[model samples]
Target: MSRHLIYLSILTSLTACAGNSRPAVQQDTTSAITGTDTLNRMVLVPGGTFSMGADDSTGMPDEYPKHSVKVDSFWMDEHEVTNREFAAFVAATGYVTTAEKPISKEELMATLPPGSAEPDSSMLAAGALVFTPPNHAVPFNDVSQWWSFIAGASWQHPEGPGSDIKGRENHPVTQVSWHDAQTYAKWAGKRLPTEAEWEYAARGGLSNQIYPWGSEALTAGKPKANTWNGNFPYKNTHTDGFENTAPVKSYNPNGYQLYDMSGNVWEWVSDLYDARYYAQVENGAANPSGPAKGYDPEDPALEKHVIRGGSYMCSDEYCRGYRVSARMKTTPESGLANLGFRCVRSVTHH
Candidate 1:
């Protein structure tokens, strides 16, 4: 679909939904080949060795200790899992996302304080975190100021119960938990890309470059990808012509013919996130699949998976996650407005 047409459709849907309701990876080496028609618009990424971490000073601690790693050949979706694509998956399989399933008492208790009483069922309603920007500038340290878990906020109803994905069929599906992504991947006969494979494809054969595109400049000339321009959580210049998610393939593709490798939304990988996993990796590892388990010193209680690329919410003043080497972590069951994913198929060796 054309970008202008998709944008128009989305605007129309947003109005109707509001009026109607109310509210609201991995592998490989030699004999590598690039071929199409293997998957739904798949792009062949002939994997090779590249520096896995960022040496830039802006990199986070977890993205440090740059090392060399190799990946085998694989076919990856050129664009993110769009709302249209996910709809097809659900239509065929009757899948229910984690955001649509009620949170269990056991799950709530796991994260709560000791002896914390389980509240009424009302508190366990199915929901997801929706980004609600504060009216005024607030400290970035407290994320609660802008994020709220709104009931009925799933991929279908992005804003809440009153909202719908009417016009956003082409936009990347958000509010999808990592488990939900895995489920869709399974149904589609594909799997989530490992962190190594993801970075390799995202780099687009550019060794150690800061972004999928050749330039390190976030906004040197025209906006290359969708990202926050003004101060984060306070203002958005919409320099990329999008304040939120854009239609898939709205921008240019990377060297590997993959789109949205940098922004629009954070793409989930199969790897379990561990901040110090890089230090433990054997040098010159081939097709590393990441740590067997997840760990994050910042928040030890939650099990997290690695999310690559960044989202429209990423900003230079705040997140800088849009950088190719930047890394972020979130629990498997937690879904936010800016979290989505793509799928990959491993090349079979004869």
Candidate 2:
């Protein structure tokens, strides 16, 4: 996403993140291997039809006009890909993520509008979006106040130069672009889930429920997912027992035996973001892959992919993105500190 067009998702317009799993480990599996042992870490989401999208308060405009969709059964990761898993991919492929590569003047220009001014050369340095909370609460209109494009920030050094993923191996890997995630999926011989499949799986066989667990609020029960407990973009009450990305399976699993399918980090799915997609798709469409083209009235300069599940930054007064049907979008290159992904495989694939 253009720094100007960041999920500043008009502030990811604070509804932002989900997944499932065992205690995450750097499982002993290779890209070429998709055996039963590896499948153990993945849940088999049964094929079914469900009312997609939500008309509830937590939902955004794109989630309205709820439609029906049918998706086939597929194998899905129980949780967001951990740093441990992503590290294995990097180690095996020596992949250089988009955030690690400097953006050029032309590249930046391409994302800008026709009459936009060119950015300074220094602004083109390699970096990813990092959350910088203020000491106190502030207005919610502008999300740029809390998000910064930090140079030297990448999945390896998530919080920038001095920070590293030393002890966060089990934590979800953030600062990864859609392209980077696609590359990892290809290397693993898997693929990103479609918007339909993701929502269906996120529902966990439930219907019209706000959260994976049910309509109950996150605070009512023992802490459900990792989300901003108090003022967002500033102070996090840590009421969820985590200040940032929590380790996988830190919370209870959903009905589908999937964990962390609501919060922790925003997840990427294989669907172009079309603000009006729900109204457009044929009711009960089977195995929908989203729209043929991307559309975002707010940021029309670049195409965007749908991102699901709110992140740690989500709050009631802000982004209620943790809701099962809540949706967010960002440019394919818009990797942020609170965004990550998981992979899935077709049932037919061995």
Candidate 3:
């Protein structure tokens, strides 16, 4: 299996949030933007300056060199895009997701090593990665142990041929590539939030906090998010009452009234992934978009986009990506059951 497929599989398998009813985050009326995407249930995120990225002790290098950034106010979805919502976009646009499109020879070879012999065309089929957890514990380095590319899998068939969204209209839609998200956003008159915009809204007016709830303790009396409770892959305690994706708003919203910002599914942002991006903007930037180009040392050949908020597979023992400042990356074409996205619209000035 290719590394791309491997990532999709394991990450998808890892698929699978919070709090009391906090008061609604107040929207700034002084500079109120007009109009609303009533279809998306958007919340107006007040503009503000914030410290972006994370510190050394608790964060990855890509999250280091914590810098300051400012973003203008914008409207963001209160939750991940649900199946019901995405269906409306497709119904209107007849839009086909990347996973629904067959991979061409050129696209396959582009990610492969030079001089590599081409495989049979049959191997290149419309598909998405379905998470197949290993029965036994295995070394984390070789991800192929659990993930496999299922030729028939697409957004409509989350687990491949037999699986369907049947009664999951309220559940967040997964198996959507970044390109697919862009298509949906465009159809809805919105766009993916830039990495900075995402993190800022995710902060929910709190600064330097770990998780969205301002607590590193994954559990305090009751489980905060739908994350793994026991050993990853091999054992899922389901303490949060879910083994996989949960419906949006299954838990409490963040301070910003944003649901599932720290768990449930990994959310794709509009930023290009560059490990050195934080270091480049140490002096602080206003409305800083991500790096112009993408680069990741792990796989320089393939471009990557940033995904945030982690997912259900996130745990204290494994990927603590549930933290607000955590960063992750995958190719734009890589979509899995654990990944989804919300949309944002810039506050237009009259």
TM-score, every prediction: 0.87, 0.90, 0.89
Clashing pairs in 1: 23-162, 24-162, 24-163, 25-192, 25-193, 25-194, 27-72, 28-72
- Model 2 / residue 248 / CA error / Å: 0.6
Give the clash count for each candidate. Answer: 8, 11, 5
Ranking by lDDT: 2, 3, 1
Question: Which 10 consecutive positions of candidate 1 have the poorest summed lDDT?
Answer: 15-24
* Index of the highest-TM-score prediction: 2
Determine which window of 10 residues in candidate 2 has minimal summed lDDT: 17-26
**Runs of candidate 2 exceeding 4 Å displacement:** 1-40, 55-58, 109-118
Worst 10 residues of 3 by lDDT: 12-21
Which lDDT tens digits does candidate 1 get at residues 1-350? 11112222222211111001111022233333322122237767886777889847768778879998989988888889888888887887799998888766676666556987866776678887788887688876667666777888999998788999998988999999888899888766678999999988888877667888865588888788888878778788788899889988888877777899988998899999898999999979999999988887755655678888888888776677777888887777776798899998887733
Of 2 and 3, which scores higher on lDDT? 2
Cα misplacement distance, residue 33 of candidate 3 (Å): 12
Error of 1 at 298 (Å): 0.9
Expressed as tens digits, the lDDT of each residue in 90-138 for candidate 2 is 9888999988988778867876779988798777888888899888877
Off by over 4 Å in 3: 1-39, 110-115
Assess candidate 3 and give its TM-score to the true structure. Answer: 0.89
Winner by lDDT between candidate 2 and candidate 1? 2
List RMSD in Å for every model shown.
Answer: 10.7, 4.3, 4.2
Error of 1 at 182 (Å): 0.7
